[model samples]
Structures are given as C-alpha cells and as structure tokens.
Target: MSFKNYISKLVFCNGISNSFKTFTALIINSKRYSSRFKKNTLDLNNNETFVYHLKSGKNKFKFYLRTFKGDIDIFYEVFWRKTYDRHLSFLKKEPVIIVDLGAHIGMTSVYLALKYPHSKIYAIEASSENFELLKVNTEAFKNITCIHAAAYFEDGMINFGNNELSYNQMISENGDPVKALSIETLMRTHDLSHIDLIKIDIEGGETELLSRNNSWLKLVDHTIIEIHTPYTPSDLRDDIQPYGFEIKSEKDSVLFAAKK
Candidate 1:
C-alpha cells in the first residue's frame, strides 16, 4: 500500500470506535506487528496469499487475501466505513430474501448475514476459484447458499472470464464456458416465492439480464444494481420503470430501485 493508503487505513480504524481505536493502536504500537498479523501492507506484501481476521462492530470476518489483484482496502471501505450503503437500511423485510449476483469471496454475503441474521441469501459467483472461496467463507452461515454458476437471462452455458480481482470477472465470449441460470430458474430451484431484494453486480451482464422478460421481478420488492455504462445503455432506468419500480442512481455506478 502507498503511504496515503496506509494513513487512510489508520484513520478509518481510528474512526470506528474508541475501543476499536485503542485495540488497533496496540497492534501498531507492538513491534510484533509482523508476527501477530499477516503483512497486508505494500512494503511487506506477499504475492501468493494471506489472511486477514477482522472485527467490525459485533461482526467478525476472515478474509483470504491474494496479492496479485484483490483489493483489501474494499473491506474497510465497503463494510467498515459503509461506503456502499451508508445507512445499511435498504432492505426492510422481516425474513429478508436476497439474491446476490457476483458474490465473489462472500464479503457482501457475510455483511448481509450479519445485518439480517434471519435472512436467506443466495450468493452466486461465476468463477470456479471465487466460488470455492465463496463456499469456504460462507460455509458457517446456514442462511447463505453459495452457487458456482452465472446469472443470465436464460438457462444455458455462456463464456466467462476469470479475473484476479474477483469482482471484475464477467461473461466474455473469449473466455471459458460456464453454466448460466435465470432469475426465475434460481427462484424456482431455491423455492423462493417472494424476493425482498436482488443485489446485482454482474459487471456488464446486467444489460442482458434486465433487458429480457423480467416478469419474475414482480415478486421482487427492491433491487440494487451496479450498472456498467460502457457495456450497457443508460436507459435501463426506463426499462425498469415499466415494472413499477422507482429508480435512483447513486455514486459508484450503483442504482437503487424500490417497488412503487
């Protein structure tokens, strides 16, 4: 990590809470920093792999990190700092049902599990490596179901690209073929009658998925999607409006749509 990134992390850690700040300070003060924790800093960076055991609020997480492309900073930014959804108050279901596309290593899945303890989360990842880690990371959560398949408009096989940054993996004609499942098929296979929220971050595949026959979306109450503008047109809001959803675009390509 750069000097700026390191300092930013320290600031983020300090901002968590007085108790957490004190605990983090002890780690930094100890000369055994290298021994106590895996070196996640750029200076002592390990290219192969490392693990970060983190505690935020009342939730604990174990992240398996890789040096080549994964961004460890996202954990602090998204979960700890609440950069993605600051309020963490989007879903309002009693027993929430969430479909997480592009679950990656299950960070978001774990976040949802912690926030909504009674919720059922289906975490789907396309890449085999990411799916393996997804299962490992989420195995302890009985409410979380990890699937090694792509979410598309139809049931079939499509080419998928595996990237070192787990989030960047997407469907590409030049990549290897992988099984694809539609939203209806997933809901049917899992026996979900009504979906509270559908969180989509499937790179550019959102275009095709949202453009297709989305009759199944009537059962969904809300949706959070990250639109890839380069690969998809901005008129997706129009596409969803007809489905009785009111759309609001947020920073970082995120769109929030609630049922009207």
Candidate 2:
C-alpha cells in the first residue's frame, strides 16, 4: 500500500477503538474467523450514533456511523479498502452525467465527484434522515445535486421502510411514504439527453424497476447495482440482457452492467 493508504487504514482502525468493548470483541473474533464471520456474530451497541471525520490526502469526509447499523464497516470498506474503486475507471471523460440511486449519505457521489471533477451527479436518497446527511456531506461539491426521492418506475409517492441503517432502508407497502421518480423523469427534469452511469442500490426495489418497462435503460450507458438476494429474481440477468447490457457479478451483492 502507499504511505497515504497505510495512514488511512491506521487512522480508521484506531478511531474505532473509541467503542472499546465493540472494538475488543471485533479483534478477538477476527483472529478466529474471517471479518464477515465477525461482522455477523459481533454484538454491537446500537442505542447511539457515532460520527467520524476521515481524510484522504486533502479530501475530508464526515460520516455519521453506527456499528450496529453496519455503517462503520461500510465506511471502512468503501473509503479505506476502496470497494467501489472499479466504478471510477468506467467514466472515460470529463463532464459526464451520473445518477446515484440509493445514495445513502452521498459517499459514492462524493467519491465520484472528486475523482471526476467535471462530472455532474444527481444523488438520490429515499430516507429523510439520510437525505439530510447526504445534503450536508455533499454540499461542498458543486457538481453534486442531492435529491430526496426514491428511484421508481413512475413519478409519484411510494411507501418506504426507513431505518437507522441507511443501506437497509427499502421500499415497502407499510412504511412512510416518499416521492418517487422514474429514470425518464430524472433525465427530463435535469435536461440531460443521456446518462453516462446510473448507480443503484435501492434494496429489492430494483426487481420492480428493472422488470418493468425499461425503455429508459437505453438512455443509460452503464449501471452498477447492488441486488438484494432472494428478493431479486434469479432471471434478473436475463431480464436486463435484452436491453443490450452485459452483466458482470462482483463480490458482495454488486452487479455491473454495461451497454454492449
């Protein structure tokens, strides 16, 4: 690793020690099995939220994290381990357009904004609480436009399950209602002819959106989706194949589809 990356890892690992008990358990169990094993078995206190301000070179990011909510591990993976590093190389030019569905606290949007300085990004989040943080986290970037809405097949209201863990929030029939927007609406609203990339991680809502009339998918050049298992049909690959997108499954629940 480079000196900067080494320092970042050291800082992140050391910073988590503030939650001493949780940190201790993670250490002990991490030796016995894989990190995934520890993640599944560790008992983390969830009563309160924690904030961490992290820096990479001159770029700084503020994360409202909770171990119980798995935000800490996600921050570690995305920022420290560079889990979405592969997505960065897909955009080959400046002034590209990206739509970030399920933007969470705008981490991916921020990363992309910084990496592709000239790109215009629409960061969409469903949860009210997360949208507030998403706005705050991405405010410094002029290219990021944060939207408090869910990406759906239609432009209307939909029920959503809000939770402390932003990633776990999903569209449901029995949760708080939020406004939804279709890809076509988004493109028209933003006055964009085409989107270079659309990154989606809307829990299981992808099944409905992707399975529905996907004529708008033709306007997108690429997509990075995190498909929730079992809930998403196994034929999702086949479903998207006719759109001229070739699917490549990655580690975790991530899938990348590029127009062929």
Candidate 3:
C-alpha cells in the first residue's frame, strides 16, 4: 500500500473533507481511532472497483476490488447492507470451519473473516479474473485460504460460463473448461471433518448442486445460499429439508438452512 494508493482509497471511500478528518485522526489520535469510514469506488487495472478502508483497534484493513457491477452491488450488500448477518446469526461456536462458494472478489469472505477471526475459511472462486482480486482482498487475513475452482456436483473439469451480470457466473455446457470441485472433495482436500458454515451463491446452479448426489449434507451443519431464477424456495426446501435442515429465506433473496 503506497501513499498515493492510500490517499486514493481515502478519497474514494470518504469524500475529501472526511478523508482529511480521517487522516488527521489517524495522525493525531491513531490509537483511539475506530472504523467509521466511507464507501465508494476506485478505477484500477482498467476496471472499476469498490474501495473501503477501516481500522479495528490498532490494525487497518482495506478491501480493494476490480470488477464490474458485481463489485459495487456485492460490496454494498455484504458490508453496508448486512446481507448475511441475519442468516449467520446462529453461528455461536468459535474456531469453526467455513467454505465459501462463489466468493466473488471475497467480500463475504472478508466480512466473515472479520466477524469470526478465529475461524478457518476457504474462499473459492471459479473465474481466474475474479480470483486474483479475491486473493488481494483476503490476503490481509491469515484465516482465509483461497481456492480457484467452481463448486459443482462433480469433481473434474466443467464448463464455466460467464453472464452479463458479473456476479452470476455459472457452469454451463457452452462455457470454457475450469476445475470443478464437489463438496466432498473440498472437505477431503482441506481435511475438514465437518463444516460449521458453508455459503453457496453460484447463481441458479444450486438447483443442480442440491439436486445432485449431495450426501455431503451430512457433514454440513449450516448453509446459506442465494436463490436465482428457476430455482424457487420450494426447490431449496425439497432438496435440503430431508437432510433435517430447518430452512428459511431471508428478505435479501437467500435461503439459510441449519440442522435441527
């Protein structure tokens, strides 16, 4: 983080006046500064990205991204809007293991890492482009491990297609080949005996995933997923309820399931 980039993030997140106030606070009251910053975007690597700067106690974190509509909406939804807080309210255990599917640029992973700093998190992304930024954002946290693979029902190469909406990329027959890992495979690769929280937001592809050979549900205690078109709430209920998850949908278009 260079001085130029630091000031740029300050300006992008907080306006000039607030940036000045934050700067002065940092220099004058460095030890007492709590994270009350701004939200805005930055132009980086020929793409626009959302930039947010925060300080927790004596440590500082910057979530910088390079993306399309995905950056703005996802960042706002996860950070300012508190999209997952409701779904995640049941997480009372510490030192838990988490797997994040469709971890686009790692906003959710970053948020979760901060919320559960002692927990281990695997942030998985399919797109090579998005994974780069995901790495950058999650690097500040030691608890987050990033994987470049799509969480499909099978463990092999699969067709990964893009969408006009940057956040909704999915596996398709017409798409390019990418490494596909299953829930079982992820657990095995990470040597995870059980997962405390697993997040799935792979567009509409969850229908196929939940419908497929999902014996892995036995190992998952809690899951939260965003439902897309053609994958209704009934579909989600029918797929996971038999596994004994008390399923409910939050207002922001996501379903959360926890073991009874």
The most accurate candidate by lDDT is 3
**Model 3 Cα lDDT, one tens digit per residue, 1-260:** 47985555445444312345444433332112111112323222345444556554444676664433446557656765578988787766753898999998898998888888889999999977788889988888999999999988888898886544557677777777889889888889889999988999997778888899898988889999998988888888888888888885466578788888
Local distance difference test values of all predictions, in order: 0.72, 0.73, 0.75
- List residue ranges in candidate 2 displaced over 4 A: 1-8, 11-51, 66-68, 162-164, 231-234
Look at candidate 1 and give me any clashing residue pairs.
1-42
Clashing pairs in 2: none
Question: Which has the higher lDDT value, candidate number 1 or candidate number 3?
Answer: 3
- TM-score rank, highest first? 1, 3, 2
Q: Estimate candidate 3's alpha-carbon lDDT, on a 0 to 1 scale.
A: 0.75
Instruction: Kindly list the per-residue Cα lDDT of model 2 for residues 75-186, writing each as its tens digit.
Output: 5676557777775466456538989999987878887787777889999999887787788888778899999999998889999875435568888777799999888898
Residue 183 alpha-carbon offset, candidate 1, angstroms: 0.6
Model 2: which ten-residue window has the lowest total lDDT? 25-34
